[model samples]
Target: MSQEKLEKIEKAGFVLKPDSPEIRPNYERVREAFESRGIEVLLAERSARMIGEKGMPFERMCVESDFLVSLGGDGTLLSLVRRSYAWHKPVLGINAGNLGFLADVTIEEVETFLDQLFSGEYRIDHRLMIAGHIRKASGAKIEFFALNDVVISSPVTSKMVIVNAAIDGERFNSYRGDGLIISTPTGSTAYNLAAGGPVVYPLTKAFILTPVLAHSLTNQRPLVVPADFRIELDTEKYEAVATIDGQERYDLEEGDVVTIGGAKEGARLLHRKERNYFSVLRDKLHWGERNW
Candidate 1:
C-alpha cells in the first residue's frame, strides 16, 4: 500500500485499447466525464488516430499530464504503466473489457470515481515491478521491464528446457520442464497460480520461482525469495524464448543468461478507497463457492 496522495489532478493522459475503433464512443463518454469535472484529457498519438482525433506524442502527453489513464482491460493498463514508468505518474484504469485484476474501475463507475478522486477519497497502490535483462552468448544484452512475471519457455511444444538457476552469484537449482516463471508478487495470480504457485499478497516484496511441469521424480516446488536478491537463469542445451508480461519476447541461445530483480521504483495504481483484495480473489477465482 502506498501512503502517497496525488496532487490536484488538473490534467490526465489517456491511452485506449489498441486496434479497436469501436471503443471510440466509450472514450468520448469518459472524456466528457473528466472534462465536466474541469480535468483536461490528453490522448496518445496512436490511440487518437484510431479514434480519428488529433493527439500529441506519447512523451509529451506524459510530460504535460498530472496523471495517466488506461481505457481497456488489465493488459492495456499494464502497457500504459510500463511505457510511462519514467514519468512516475499515477495511473487509473477504466475497464472496458472483462472484470480485470488491475483495471478494477468499470465504465459505469467512472463518474462516481471521478467524484471520489476530487474528494480525496481514493487509494493508490504501489505494486512491485520486474527489472530484467538478457545477456546473449555474443556479449550483447536486451533489457526490459515487466509489471507481472518473466517467463522462459521452450520454443517447441515437444521439447523440454533445462533452466539452470543461480541466486546472488551462487548456483542453486536446475529446472527441467516446459519452462520457469520468475514472478513478482503482483503476478502471483497470473500464470503462477495456474502452475500451482502461491498467491502472494501484491504488496509483498518477493520473487517467486515456479517451474512449469517439472520432469523430476523428486519434490520440486515454487521458491520465494526476497526481492532484493538477484536471480539468474540460463537454458543449458535447449533453445528458449523469454517473455515479459506475456507481451514481449526475445530468443535465447544456449549460453545466454536471463537476470531478474525487483525494480527500484514500483508502479502506482489508483483505485476506489474501498477496494478489497480478498473480495477480488473470491469473485475472480470463485473461492468458497458451492457448485452443487
Candidate 2:
C-alpha cells in the first residue's frame, strides 16, 4: 500500500442496493450512522428499484469519490465494481446472501466496520478481471471487461457446438459441449463453482477454463491457466453466445475468434479486520467436519 492509496480511502464513498427488502432498512440505518459520523456517501440510483424505496438522488452524488462500500450480496457487490470501471473506486461488500465470498461484512457490523475503516485497520486486495473481445470477420469488434467469468455457450440451444481452445497461439483442446467458461480467480466460486470448477483464492493470478456439459465425460474437469496467457475460442458451429459476469452478453458466429485474458484494470476490494479468505470459505462452504 502506497501512502497515496491510503489517503484516497480515508475519504470513502458508498454504493447501496435499494431493492432487497431484507437489506433496505439496514442500508438506511448504516448510511445514517456513517453520515452522522461525517463519512461521505455516494448511493447508486438503481437501488430505488432494487429496494422498493426511493434512493438517494443521483444528481446529488458524484461518481469520482474515494472508496465505495457495497451493501448487498455478492451479486450486488459485482454490480458496484462494474459501475466503478471509470471511477476505479475501492469497494467493500456486506453479505446479505447465503454464501458471500465477495461480501465481507454483515449488516450487524456496519458501524463498527466503519469505525475500523476510518481508523485504517482494513486492507484492500486487488482482484483480477477478464477482458473479452468480440471479433467479426467483417472488421468490426467490441471489447468489454468483467470481474467474473466470461461464458460462451448454448445453454438451451437445440444443438451441441464444437469449440477449439487455444492458449498463446497453441492449440489446447477441442470441446464438443453446450458452452465454455473463461473465469477470473474472483469468479471461480460463482457460476464456475456450480459448473464444477475449483474455488480459486483471491491471491491466485490465474484464469479458469471449464466446459459446460461436455458431450464426453473424459474431459469434463476444469483447467486453470496463467493470467497473462491469451485464450482464444474457435468455433465451428454458429448460434453461440458469450456473457460477461452474467450481466452482459453477445452472439458468436461460426469461425468467430473470441480472445480472453487478464484485464489491465482490477477491482480494489476491501476486507474487514476479522475477515479472511479461509474464514469466509469455511463458513460459506461448510468446510468443517460433519457432526455425524
With a 3 Å backbone cut-off (N, CA, C), the pairs that clash in candidate 2 are: 18-50, 18-51, 19-50, 19-51
lDDT of 1 at 247: 87
91-190 per-residue lDDT for model 2 (tens digits): 7888765548888688777778877877877878888977779787666888888898888887467578778899999997988887788888889888
TM-score of 1: 0.98
Q: Tell how far residue 85 is off in model 1, in angstroms.
A: 1.1
Model 1 poorest 10 in a row by lDDT: 1-10
- What is the Cα-based lDDT of residue 237 in candidate 1? 80
| Model 1 lDDT per residue over 114-185, tens place | 999988889999999998899999999898989999999988885799999999999999999899999988
Native-to-model Cα distance after best TM-score fit, residue 226 in candidate 1, in Å: 0.8
Candidate 1 structure lDDT: 0.93
The Cα error of candidate 1 at residue 157, in Å, is: 2.3
RMSD of each: 0.9, 2.8
Number of clashes recorded per candidate: 0, 4
